[model samples]
Target: MNNEAIDIILAEDEPALGMIVKESLETRGFKVRLCNDGAKAYKAFEESQPHALVLDVMMPELDGFSLAKKIRLENEQIPIIFLTAKSQTEDVLEGFDVGGNDYLKKPFSMEELIVRIKNLLNRQEVQKTAAIYAIGDYSFNFPKQRLTYKDDEEVKLTHRESHLLYHLLQKKNKVLDRSFVLKKLWGNDDFFSGRSMDVFVTRLRKKLAKDDRIEIINVRGYGYKLMVP
Candidate 1:
């Protein structure tokens, strides 16, 4: 892994622990900014635009779960690791349910955490095909969550929107099962998440409306189809 390519936002309420971890990562050539609370971490995330996040599940003001959910609203693909004392099966599941890519138990070895970070970053990089896709008159950069319309400026899509669009495009002219998508994304095939998915679909529709040839058709009571000419 290229350590130079990484920038991290770490949030831990314990000041001593946070500093130690920050210094250790910095020693290994990672640019890490440590914050003691979730709200400060979020602000740093917005300002620094870090490549990954290491957040404590229990934090002052926002807490890691809430912060992670907030971040997911705008960016779904960024890597997040929850470093906390909570280590129950349910706790780990809860971390992932909020869009975290990984979870580490408290009292973890900094070395182990480093390895996990590298592995997660490498894994995500491997997923990128580095190919721009054509959807109607728009060009999509899936890795960047970007869509370019020939007649106007580029549209930046939220993480959920981008992933939903990807599935639709891959299954073009075919049905993408509603429950399947909900389970894969929100970790549950329930009514509330289904409604949330619908909201995302509507947002995508509006964004892609410029291209008349691109149609996201909902297969009533089933799923959605991305019809491309």
Candidate 2:
């Protein structure tokens, strides 16, 4: 199956602009869901689990940063792209700090956004096939699909879940790209696979939750990081 159809959740307050971006991406063979507010974007994210998120910096109810933070808490490995009129360095830095993977200023070209998204997604795919990875307080067995902690019980993982975990584990403290994972594992980075990946991530998180020393940090626009402390 073709995995080229990467899904994206676009949160833009401007109606005309949102439509343009969504239509442009769809024309480029991407599946995009356009949202008007930060709150709705978050809801769509929870339900759709799009490969990547295009978030507007300012909005009513939640704003991009807050939504990103919330999304991070839920899933650490979803790619997020920020769209904003603010070009200040501090704002950009703050966005990065909040886990944004990429930022596009207002009046940005669709081509440019697409390029950045593709680049980020490509990086995510490379990490998935990594054979060796350290996750949290455990060593991730990629081929075996298991994470062995310092305890007697080792959790065995399913094929897709293991592949996803391996991808995140390889990233270590860095963000793993969302589209990269969906394309590599499910052969598509579309809406459905994105949702599936979320479920898998949830399972992985539950298994790893036993260790308080490790954290799976979610970078809003890029992906998740398996932080081993």
lDDT: which candidate is best? 1
lDDT of 2 by residue, 153-227 (tens): 788764456666767766777888888986665445766556656666777788898788777776786767777
TM-score of each: 0.58, 0.58
Clashing residue pairs, candidate 1? none
- Tens digits of lDDT, candidate 1, 1-229: 5898799999999988999999999998999988999999999988878889999999999999999999988777788988988766556656765877766777888888898788667746844765778988998888887899984679987555677788888899999999888766554677756766787788889999998888889999999999998
For each candidate, the alpha-carbon lDDT, in order, equals 0.83, 0.75
Native-referenced Cα lDDT, model 2? 0.75
